[model samples]
Target: MHKEQRDGRQEQLSDILGKLFTSRGWGRKNDRLRIESAWAEAAGPELLKDTQVLVIKRGVMEVAVRNAVLMSELAQFHKRKLLTKLRAAMPGVTLTDLKFRAAAW
Candidate 1:
């Protein structure tokens, strides 16, 4: 295939994938990945292992902690600071609160 033909086909495929993702609401999945990355940065490695960013809904982020003691400490002591870091890290996303819970898994 010619270079020009390959380029045209690549662009067409890109458009098709974009439309498919949009139609299936895959953008939210992308946003979730970004949020998880931001959470890792904001929470740091030591805490990252003990916590997981479950989901975000209506500006509230639900996080799963490894244990109830850690959850309590995070909810009482670190919640505000974590929220501040998260909001700063992802300015485009609305992160108003952090809810901590013991991990179901």
Candidate 2:
């Protein structure tokens, strides 16, 4: 209701949520909505699928497309769109390069 009451409630909720997650061994980042975008394919096919993130610290992102032709296709056409999507998902998470390579091709 009051300003001070609202502030207190917010703090209390933050503390409670922190404690609950800590007790469960779920780190704070677990609940964080990670990067979800076409660019996320670099992290792995499944990492982004399950965790909603493309946690790559390196500028180069490794994605196994299995076909050099398709990799080139994506790099040329889809690269820009994928970058845009990743930027939209994680505004401050800077990613500059996409390294599309085949694992077996």
Candidate 3:
């Protein structure tokens, strides 16, 4: 009822929500979504549609491409530019490299 009581309750609510997000892995999910969005923007819609963001182990991001030709192009030519764009887009994310694999899906 009092201002102090309301403020304390608000702080407690904030803490509870923060813990819930962490415990439920919502934070990681959000980070994944952000990463996907950044990848989509950087890779362009056409490339994104044929590729999937598999995982991020250490600082390397593993991407699955639909075909060997695209995979080769990405790995051989676009790798550097893509990495730079990804890093710039996701400044907080630790993205050291992009590894592309030919995968059927």
Top TM-score prediction, candidate number = 3
What count of clashes does model 2 give? Answer: 0
Q: Which lDDT values do the candidates have, in the order given? A: 0.88, 0.56, 0.88
Ranking by lDDT: 3, 1, 2
Clashing pairs in 2: none
Q: Candidate 2 lDDT (Cα, whole model)?
A: 0.56
Winner of 2 and 3 under TM-score = 3
Candidate 1 TM-score to native: 0.77
In model 3, where do residues sit more than 4 Å from their true spots?
1-13
TM-score of each: 0.77, 0.48, 0.83
Off by over 4 Å in 2: 1-33, 36-55
**Candidate 2 local lDDT, 24-91, one digit each (tens):** 86874553435334445433464343232324557544555655676687778877776666656665
